[model samples]
Target: MGAAIDPQVLAARVRNALPAKFASEKRMFGGITFMVNGNMLCCVSKRGLMACVGAAAEPEALARPFASPCFGSGRRMAGFVTVAPPGVADADGLNYWLALARTYVEATPRNASGQKRWRRKSAATEPSRAAA
Candidate 1:
């Protein structure tokens, strides 16, 4: 196994690599997720650096060293890849993944609301509703 990753260090690197405009951070997937134009671009979590490289590029991305498909609820999350710490231990490697994610995010069509279309909310995070 590779050296353990420092979450704070990896988060800082992701922040530094992101463009100043059109980028925002949110807590999701048990980590810090970077969004571009209201769409998920990448995230830093225990699993490593997860990038939304788009479904078309998924095959190629997975072929790269230390890259693997991201899974959720026992199913593959198409278009997302988790790169191990060793893959993003350096600036160049991180930049490569970030760039790929950025390109895909930028190409995605924006919703009329100009906000994230959907996200699964945990019970704790979801707002409660009561019959009036």
Candidate 2:
């Protein structure tokens, strides 16, 4: 399926708020993700915006209206929160979340080598997409 508008707009707004040197965009999980210092800073998925504010801030971030603990696939991601579409309807609201994520991202260390730190599982570990 094609990408949805609300998430797309949310992603764009956050991307704009990030410092050029701190943010790099990558498309993943059928949405846009912003990486900072080789770590995932934030992303906008079909459900809405997902922010990684570090483990310490997750509780406060989840208190916002329309905010919820975030998950990837079926498992919960401890440091992330999902800001619902209603929560980020306006630019100001969008930036508010962006600022939260930026704070944690800014404090994180960067890998100057610039090599990708994550590795995908081998195709052999899973079922094939091709029909039998």
Candidate 3:
């Protein structure tokens, strides 16, 4: 049998290796997602590391030993790629995936409605306008 995985440790390692421009958020998917400039670049799930690469790179990634589609749908997860288990086991491999994610995130435009779609806070924070 394989060794048990520690999600917290994996998250910490990934967070430390990522560039300062990136930010991390704990996701309900039982993984931590790394975002660059407010855009999601990568995620660390129970399966392994996942990066958000566009469709162009999907073919190459799929042929890689530790690479796979980010989801089971068979359709490439937009802006996301799954890093093989071996890749997540070491710093070098993890760094490689992070670099790819960073590049993709930097090149892509920020989602127009991404913020409004994912924001969890209440609308009370908005300032009230005087009624006419």
Candidate of highest lDDT = 1
Model 1 misplacement above 4 A: 1-3, 111-132
Candidate 1 residue-wise lDDT, 1-132, digit = tens:
445687778998988777577678888888898887678888897667889999999999999999988987899999999899999999999999998998898999764334555888998886777633
What's the number of clashes in each of the models?
0, 0, 4
Candidate 2 lDDT by residue in tens digits, 9-57:
6776776777667778888766798887777777887777888888998
Estimate the lDDT of model 2. Answer: 0.79
lDDT of each: 0.86, 0.79, 0.70
Error of 2 at 129 (Å): 27
Using TM-score as the yardstick, the better of models 2 and 3 is 2
Pairs in steric clash, model 1: none
Worst 10 residues of 3 by lDDT: 1-10
Residue 84 error for model 2, in Å? 0.5
Best by TM-score: 1
Taking all chains together, the TM-score of candidate 1 against the true structure is 0.81
As for TM-score, the candidate ahead, 1 or 3, is 1
